[model samples]
Target: MDPKTALPLNTSRNMPILGLGTWQLKDDTAGTIAAALELGYRLIDTAVDYGTQPGIGEGIRRSGVERSDFYLVTKVEETDDAYEATRAYLGELGLDYADLMLIHRPPSSGPGEDLWRGLIKAKEDGLTRDIGVSNYSTDRIDRLIDATGEVPAVNQIEWSPFGYSDDMLRYGREKNMVIQAYSPLTRGKRLDDTTLGEIAGKHGKSPAQVLIRWNLQRGTAAVPKANQRAHLEENIDVFDFELSEDDMARLDGLNERFSSLGRLPYA
Candidate 1:
């Protein structure tokens, strides 16, 4: 039940399901990233918009861990120069290539297909090992496939028991795209929910752990963030426990079609 064990990313390799989310995590980036690496987290998610790449880089350097041992992911923010910008940023981060690179969000100002072309190029040129989209809708996904003739390797979305989207998940699965759940803890809104609390009580765990376990059971990879050392440790501790089928059903019943952000056309 070691969390470091990577799950099947298809048959060729595995990806660690539980990862460290780097949103709004900066200033103490090196220290925090180093600490998390020391704590046994192999997957780290960051983005250009987060303004923490330098810190992440510093952390990685300080951690003294070999780059090949970690699954490093970053994103290209929606900007006029997304491709070049991402390349420059990664240069600053001092990594030759990222394990995964995503389109941070559907561009609001330009052709998403054009931006995707840049991502495809990055993948082809080996700047990124895998390229994908984030915050994309099913329609957007279809258009992307039509343009690129290849589905994204991963589609990161906001998924939680509170706001489950079976349609999106099903579509991503059909395409062999990994469904990565961001904000899987519901941004602290559902930590005190009666049902989640009940499940936590039964398992002697926290509500956050219950939610993460639910995501793992559903076969979705999750990146849950926590700045506190204790909280970070607690987040990855779910691998040792397995929820019962009945408990899984009860948690599944808690889906309310809720969304922290109003339903946007894109993810």
Candidate 2:
């Protein structure tokens, strides 16, 4: 797959198939983002909860890239007022509008019915161009649609070959929603798998590259976080080789429902 490929949203916009995720980035957030931008990364994924919005804004200023050229994604937590929180997030990012905003997770008390409304409101007010959800099960998403009469444009999830789910993939395809994959590298935990090693060796690629290629071939947007120059380069260098059907099948079978976040099944 081409590294420049973009996945269509339910809306008119298209999200870059690969993006830079800022979760634990701290003091180096601005430098890392600036470097990633220099490497031609056009999509940036962050959240108010990550406390990296300020750095992201600073990085964008330092990159000298045009705002319209790149995609910006941020999120509102389940506990916060989605609309107001979205406004605050924009203020932090020093942007007037975000390309996309997502509800960080399902609410503890409800199926995110109220939170969904807030996100929709933000979109209606032009605070965001598109809105979606993160860490939401299919059932919860259905309920949101039922309650708000709107389909989320994307669903961010903790997904990797080891944590694969056919049902989730099918759900995204059926809904015409992009599944933004976080931690596609397994956070450096499962890189030692013998099967993954074999596949990587056969293709003359690293295990991390193999994993990222798997996600890209499946059409899921993989946002692997990397602050170092080497990792930043390695993460986005998956466009050179293609994995065969057999290779994909082997990787798919590696799924043991593994999730570092202890996520439950997408019932």
Candidate 3:
């Protein structure tokens, strides 16, 4: 549960287990990111659809932290051309290279194999150091590997004590993929759960801290977003304590396959 803990990627890169998610931090995106960096967040997650890449890049520069010290993650939308989109993302961020790039989701009309190829090509061209996917089921990931003969380095999914599956965790381990958890706090939907509150009370930590610790304890990376300085500090402060096995089981029992993004069942 070390704050500086990083999981090894199949791509030979390491991703910090905890990061700042810039989903709705559209306004003052740069300022938010810069603040997160100052507060000790080494990983910053953004996406093409989030429309925060410009600010993200600017924030990184403003932080005065060398680009190599941070893990920068961005994604390509399903509608955009993967290769071209990767180029566009680099351009928008004004970065010569990205630490990681992901396919935001599968396109509605075409097979994702094409998009997977586009990501692979981006890696081949050195546009990004690592490549992965988001919102893709294990079967879809397998199909991409079968078609491209290349495995994804990570799978970004909506994972929390209430929404994740043991099967997905096993699948990720078997495939050597790092499962990055988005909405690890369940978007504040389950923060007030009695079980979570009890656990947080026991550790003298906030419910959000308990949830973030659960993600790390399960061996997945988490990206929790915060706009306020207090929240930014609170979110990354889960590294100091450990959740017991009994508490972990209690939290695991709360799972109902709930998706914060409204994608119930998450199949």
Candidate 4:
């Protein structure tokens, strides 16, 4: 698969099917990002809570890649003054606008109408090219659409064979929302699973590569985190092989609603 291959959005934007996730990457954020950029990563996922925005921006500059060559994503706090928070994060990123911005999670009360509205407002003002949500249930996603008269272009969630369900996958397909998979490697917890190991051996690939290929073959975007050059290369080297139908089915059977993030209210 092309490293830059992307899925179409409800808006006039397109998102790369693969991205580099920046959770807990603050210490060497700039160096890591700059290296990944050189390694052909176009989509870079970060959040305000990650506290790596400044380093990410510096990495983009340090890479000497044109701003237009990259697709940037960031998330906002649910309780944040959404629009203003997004704007401030943009300043921290040293970018005029983000390619995508998402509500980190649905707030505890109400339907998060205000948060959605603020994100929409940010998009309208060109603070972001697109707006979406993360860790949202199907009903919560519907509520946002019903309230805003606009469907999110992407719904990001913790997705892996172990953490995702077929129903959620189908729902995203029905809604035409690209389901961006985070923690697709399950934070290295499931890499040692027997099923993953068997499949990896057959493909002469690492379990991590097998997991990522599963996501790409399923048509959802994946953002796997890797800080070292070798790990980054290994993560992106998954495009060379295709998983068979039987392999896909075997992996799908591993779903157990498990999440490394613990029990999410929406999950």
Candidate 5:
């Protein structure tokens, strides 16, 4: 496996760094996912709320790839009965175990700890190989670890050139948690940024590609969503090229306080 292309999930195994995000890739999700698999995308990101689990499973089946070869991930949305609800929902996906599972959002209720404990149990029961949390604040992660005596294997957050959070990233690293970036493209807000455009010009790549490479260089696993076939292919074609130290520094200078989507503190 490619060293830069893989990430270690706790002490278990390495997961692919680039994954196909299925946030809004419905309707033709199965076909698209199948195409992505054929095109060599081994990591897939989905959520129970995405309503495409069945299609994802169908795509995986049709791809003719061994289940063990893919790194499958899904998230459980915050709900009053997140434990039982997530258990039932994942059961419907028909997978024996997921490579990674995360709480979609930090729970507002006091039972957030209970939900995490349930996920830990799921890991022990072989329902998931690794368990994590998404959109969690630094305080929340510290508190949970204190409460459960377990640190999350990963922490998925909205990260991009414009929305980089040094504090959260530092904390995750301090806890030995993998930081997975969900919107590494900044939702296309910085596609036309002058700095990225210049970097792309020098490298003969797209601005999006440059941004994705920036994420990789920063040591964060990124999953950028694209429903179009060409876009999907373009997103994963980032591995062939390498960014220079100067180029990386230029891109690093593009970091702003928050995403163009506005800052929403972790709940």
Candidate 6:
């Protein structure tokens, strides 16, 4: 349960299990990131569309932490050339290469075989240490593998106990793709639910901590967004205790495909 604990990738690299998700993080991005890094958070998630890339670069500089000490993930728009987009994102991040790069979504017309190929080339040229996809179905990933013969190192999705299903975990285990869980805290939308409240009261933990711990115990990476100091500390302080079998089963039963981002296409 160490803060820096990570899961392995198909590319033989380790991706941190817990991270800071910067979905709409724009104001004071540098300050928030700098604080997180100093507090032992090593994995950071952002996207080109988030417009926080420059701020992230500045945060890393402000933290006085070595660039290699943390894992950075960014996404490319599915329309642009993945390789060029990766290069451009690198510049915006002020880093030579990102730890991981992802296709933000699958192509509208097809499975994005060509875009996947571009990511393969980017990995070869070291624009990113590993390549992945976000918001992709398992079937779409299969098509990418069939066309390129390369499996994605990670598949990020909006996953939480409320939106849970065993399908993605089974496929991820079968293919060695880490399922990075975004919005693992449910965006604070369902934190006040009675079930979550009961569980939190039993464990003497906040509902948010329970949600994150569930992700970690299930073996997928969790990324919960937070900019405030108290919230950040609470998010990372989930390692001291473990949820029991009953707790896990009850949590699993709460799944109803809930998602603040609307219905996920994942199956």
Give Cα-based local distance difference scores for all models: 0.82, 0.89, 0.88, 0.91, 0.80, 0.92
User: Can you give the lDDT of residue 20 in candidate 4?
Assistant: 98
- What tens-digit string does per-residue lDDT give for candidate 1 at 82-113? 56866887886889888888888887764388
Indicate the TM-score of model 4.
0.98
Candidate 5 at residue 190, lDDT?
74
Model 6 misplaced regions, further than 4 Å = none
Residues 165-189 of candidate 2 have per-residue lDDT tens digits of 7888999999998998888888889
Once superposed on the true structure, which residue ranges of model 1 sit more than 4 Å away at CA?
A: 10-13, 109-111, 264-267
What TM value does model 3 have? 0.97
Model 5 worst lDDT window (10 residues): 258-267
Q: Sum up the clashes in candidate 1.
A: 1
| True lDDT of residue 247, candidate 3 | 97
Model 4 C-alpha lDDT per residue in residues 1-267, reported as the tens digit of each score:
789898998777799999999998866999999999999999999998888899999999999999889999999897899999998999999999999999988888966889999999999998999999899998999999999898889988999999786777888888888899999999998899999999999999999999999999999999999987888999999889999999999999998888888854356
Which candidate number would show the highest lDDT if scored against the true structure? 6
Which 10-residue window in model 4 sums to the lowest lDDT?
Answer: 258-267
lDDT of model number 5? 0.80
TM-scores, one per candidate: 0.94, 0.97, 0.97, 0.98, 0.93, 0.98
Please give the lDDT score at residue 193 for candidate 6.
83
Per-residue lDDT for 67 in model 2? 86
Best-matching candidate per TM-score: 6
Arranged by lDDT, best first: 6, 4, 2, 3, 1, 5
Candidate 6: residue 147 lDDT (0-100): 95
**Candidate 6, run of 10 with poorest lDDT:** 258-267
- Mark the 10 consecutive residues where model 3 has the least summed lDDT: 258-267
lDDT of 6: 0.92
